[model samples]
Target: MAIRDAGDQPAAGIYGLSIETEPMEAKLAKALPSGEGWQYEPKWDGFRCIAFRSDSSVDLRAKSGKPLGRYFPEVVALLADLPTPNFVIDGELVIEVEGKLSFDALQMRLHPAESRVRKLSRETPSRFIAFDMLVDTDGMPILDKELAYRRARLEDFRERIEADPAYLTVSPATKNLREADAWLSRSGGDTDGVVCKRIDEPYRPGERAMMKVKRLRTADCVVGGFRYERDSELVGSLLLGLYNDDGLLDHVGFTSAIADIEKPELTARLESLKGGPGFTGKAPGGPSRWTTDRSSDWKPLRPELVVEVKFDQITGCRFRHGTKLLRWRPDKKPSQCDFRQIGL
Candidate 1:
């Protein structure tokens, strides 16, 4: 395999990476297709990092080709202490809080201040879960090698060099269909879903060659509120909510899948139901630094309308992303829309 630079030019000299290497990518699939050629692993919900440890240095590279060494110093230190003289391993940086994987803690490590990063590194710390090997112990490039070979080498390295399983360990893999389905079924909080790869397929760097099947489930949500377009009365997005155990409607997420023609009718219907106490449980608007300008500008509505939406995952008691609006569930009652569907 001919490795190329960012400019698409052929890489110079040896494959000795000096803080540079494009990581292989994966494609998203709705379902994991069955076959004997498939290898499945849990899709960890954390920063994807590719570690390069040389004789003199060790570097952690993110999926977007960004440097992560400054943020995750503890991981760098662990990589430096590895028994291997030099090698490249692909893995994820995860921070666990209270026995559960915390993505928020991983995000907090991206502090600009070195002091803050250092503090968090000592306080919470991070772990590296190796999944693939792009460079072998002999310092030979293995981009042309198949997934089965790379996976075996990666596992061997973990068993040999990664003596301490606390900070560095190889992710578990399975080829059994029943076990793969179990991973997908229980994917949340820590594990995002299951990633299936063809054992015979070579790692295609910067390409979506591997397939990923995330946790996708549908929920009937109460349309408790909505946000109007800046200049028009049309609906920008439908605010979604689910009743908590205390009978309080909590704003989980929203969907902007309204058709242009149906907007007028939807807007009118929503306008009629405009009222207070839309979200009794965890209402929107807070000291969140990551909010949009319209985050505080949602129009509250009567908890009467219900919608069926498909969502991938829920994190921090909210939808990880905007749920896809499936249809207006007129047959479903808003009272029926509860967190029970998500088993929350």
Candidate 2:
């Protein structure tokens, strides 16, 4: 018998391709280590997008490789009207307010109503904080080129475009690590973190080539079930789960970021999926080093939902802090959810 190599196989979707998804990701240790050769850039807090411009038609893809053109109509229009026809740019979709990035404003762009989205697009209009030039004017993948060269190409592409407020601008890199640290520190509410890239290294698409150092830690958890608010039919907390050695969903943590009004409906939906082993091996037991006697307050259900959660840390297979509900994952299966998704 021979052991299998998981790394030898390509990941599914666009991740399998040697293409950059989001220019700056929160995994900077690979790109920038202590006393190393690297160029650091401010990590913008916004949507991760890949702008694909093939001739006149333009398509904006989200970090999940989903078509984001419909969600961000204004960006699609701007990309279509760009000077270059065929080019792929990896960047962040941000909204600027008073010379600072505004993630709250960017969140408004996710409206399902096209009319409202178009209205907000005109009112608060988004900007493309382009950082990487994957496909140059020649329509060739520059993944083999050094970071310095690719950045220069990105700069040239920006110069060719008309400085329209609708298009905003591109993000520039800082050679100084101290300055990058300042950007990471004073980023406050605007910046997400700092991304450091090796100047001499080539873009290793789908690989952790560059490095990102975020101010806070976050993790993606499987929503095994949800608990209702006391005395109310509203969802209070989402029961989080992680897979264990026996290939079973195990209760890990919980998130209670559900809104006041939506909780009622959400709880009803969650109650419908109750029963069965919500968690298998090492289920959430009583008080330990991290949690207290309040563990009994939580309720379990059949694992059916998956959600992306943002947390500060993890201790004893549980979240160190309460997580914020980023979004629902109807497209992702519960089995796909696991603790391995957490980046080291």
Candidate 3:
């Protein structure tokens, strides 16, 4: 099953020894694309990397087009030692902590200090989860090949060159929609979501040609506060809050999807309810220098308004990103928006 190294050097240009191929991307979708000709894979929650190896060169590039080999020296060594040469692979750079994938540990590898990077690599070595094959050992660029054939070649390559489990892993793919849904339900922690691609689609670099479905769950939260647009009197974002175990209202996240036409009215309404309690449990403290202009103009509110919003992921008792306002829930009381709804 080994792909023969037709030449000592990689193919000339982007997929060559000096690999610089842009990784393919996926589009966010509310639901998985249905019907036939779709292959699903886990959307790994780590840095996206494209790995390449030639006769004497092994390079890893982050999705940001930055060099990753300096930070992931262990991965570089593993790729260098592999028997198969002149190949490029698209994958995620992940590190496991106590049998669970740790995205934080992977992020810590990006330090400028070489010593720090080396220490972390030794403490929690990174693993490349190969999801797709871009170039073969024969130094042939297969970016134009259909995914069905590319997957077959990748599987074949895996069979021939069994990578070390400690430093590398082959990401699993399936055609079953049920399995993908199961993965989506389990999205959080190590898994972020599920990625779906057309079976016959060729890799489209730097484009959202593939589909990704994330877990979008709804929550009823209290509009504990609101932020004004940097230069306008309109509402920019609504600070959401929920009661903790001790019955203290904690700011969980924010929603900023208020329509332009409704902003003036909503702003006036929110202004009238100002200065009761922004967040009792944990307030939006003084802004850091890095705070965005919009986030820096927040105002404490009465915490009397209740709103329903949709969120994808939560971490450290806070929403990972800004939520989308679904509707105002006057029927649901703010006290009812408790921490019990979310499983920590």
- Residue pairs with colliding backbones in model 1 are none
Error of 1 at 75 (Å): 0.7
In model 3, the Cα lDDT at residue 103 comes to 65
Rank the models by lDDT, top first: 3, 1, 2
Candidate 3: list runs displaced more than 4 Å. Answer: 1-18, 217-344
Clashes of each: 0, 3, 0
Pairs of colliding residues, candidate 2? 27-212, 28-211, 28-212
In candidate 3, the residue pairs with backbone N, CA or C atoms under 3 Å apart (3 or more residues apart, or in different chains) clash, namely none
lDDT of 1 by residue, 1-344 (tens): 12122223322323455455666656556688797899999989787888876664666777656678888887777777767767888888889899999877887886789899899999998999989998888888887899999998888787788467878889999999899999999997689788888899887776657777777676779988888865676887888899888999998887877788898998898999997668888786632333342344888998888777888778987888777886565434576577765657
The TM-score obtained by model 2 is 0.75
Q: Give the range where candidate 1 is weakest over 10 consecutive residues by summed lDDT.
A: 1-10
Q: For model 1, what is the alpha-carbon lDDT of residue 297?
A: 84
> Global lDDT of each model?
0.77, 0.68, 0.78
lDDT of 3 by residue, 1-344 (tens): 22212112433444542354667777557788779999999998777888877765777777655577888888887887788867888999899999999866876776789899889999998888989988987888888899998888888887778787677878889999998899999997688789899989888886657877767566778898888877787887888898887888898888878788999999999999997877889876543233354747568888778876888888899888888886665433476576655543
Better of 2 and 3 by lDDT: 3
